[model samples]
Every structure is written in C-alpha cells, then in structure tokens.
Target: MPNRRGLPQKWCHQELEVNEMAFSHRGNMTECKWKDKRDVYFLTTKHTASWTEVTVKAKGGPTKEIKPDRTLDYNLSKIGVNSNDQCICIILLIEEKPMKWWKKMFFHLMAHAMVNT
Candidate 1:
C-alpha cells in the first residue's frame, strides 16, 4: 500500500522499477511504465493498455520508440485540455471592458466552463 495517491511516497526519492505495470479495480488504480533516458510511470483507468511501436527522431535520425498504448491514449486524450488552454489564451488576448476584478474572473471562469463542456 503506497498512499491515498496510489504511488509510493518514495517515488520522488527513487525511480520506480522498469517494465512494472499494475492495475486494481478495487482501488481504481492503474500504472503504466515507459522510458527514454529515464523511467516514467503513468496511471490511468485503462485496462486495455499495451505497448505501441512508434518511430522517434533520435539524435541521429528516426528511431524506434516503444511507448505504452495507455500513454498514447493519454496523449491523444489531452487534445481537449490543450484546446481549452489555447481557447483561454485566445479569450484572454482580446481586450475587454474595464470592470471589477471579480467580474473579469467570472467571465474567465464562465468561458473555461463553456470550453470544458
């Protein structure tokens, strides 16, 4: 048992073992491992995750990069979040009517909520 966060507290102190993957329906926890220069752990609810073969541009040129399917899926899934951030940036760029601080914050919140939904 690690903690309420599912990962061991020592994760910051040391590297998690490589090629280690685990999932728990009871705890709703899932861990996926990947590496480049170092090991990385990705947690998700995805049970159908597996390894994916992809090419990466190495220092020399294109090379193989073995990425977890869950990682790929997670990357794919972040488009909306990225889009939301981009939208917020665009919305913020526009000059607005000079109003109270709270009013500006309220509009940003509403815009964020609208983008999320």
Candidate 2:
C-alpha cells in the first residue's frame, strides 16, 4: 500500500491485481476505487467512505451509477465554477501576436468580470 508520501511500504506491499472496489483511509484522507479505474483520493473530516446510487443520463438512457458520497459532493460544488471557466474561455479574445504579461492578465480579468456579470 502507498503511504501518505505515496511511497510503497515493504510491510504492506499488495499484489498487483484488479479489484471491483477498493478503499483505504488514513486519518482524514481516503482513497477509493469504484470500478476498473484509477483510485480517487480526497481529504474529508465529515464524510465517510460510503457509496450511493444516483441516476444519471447516459448515452442509451437514464442509468443508475454507484458513486462515492464525497465525489458526488465535490462535483456538485464545482458546477458553477466549472461553467464560469468554460464561459470565460469561450468569450476571451485570443491574440496571435506576443503581448506583455500585464495586458494578458488584464484581459483575463476582464473576461472573468464579463462572465460573472
């Protein structure tokens, strides 16, 4: 198992095998793997390593997906900020010529202001 520093420990070296679901927790930090994908780790003092089923729109139709509570909460919290970033990127002007750092920063801030308003 990998420790806090992400170094594998000799005492608890696990075999390289794929599991349907895997989970580990150290203090407030938790690492969880739901399916055949890389593990997702997060720090949380309030949430537990619990899984819940949620309905989501898939390519075929609506499907139920089992997701960790913290992952769901994290995604929900970042919806507005993610949308704002997308809007800023879409509206921001692109210059082919080289520009000064201050001009770039000013244009980026202006784009943010426009998106917020």
After superposition on all C-alphas, the RMSD of every candidate to the true structure, in Å, is 5.1, 3.9
lDDT of 1: 0.66
**True-vs-predicted CA distance for residue 113, candidate 1, Å:** 6.6
Taking all chains together, each candidate's TM-score versus the true structure is 0.56, 0.67
| Predicted model with the maximum TM-score | 2
42-84, model 1: which lDDT tens digit per residue?
6676554567788878799998766678767778899878988
lDDT of 2: 0.67
lDDT of 1 at 20: 46
Q: RMSD in angstroms, candidate 1?
A: 5.1
The TM-score measured for candidate 1 stands at: 0.56
In model 2, where is the ten-residue run with the lowest total lDDT? Answer: 10-19
lDDT of 2 by residue, 26-67 (tens): 777665544425544454667777878889898999988777
Task: Give Cα-based local distance difference scores for all models.
Answer: 0.66, 0.67
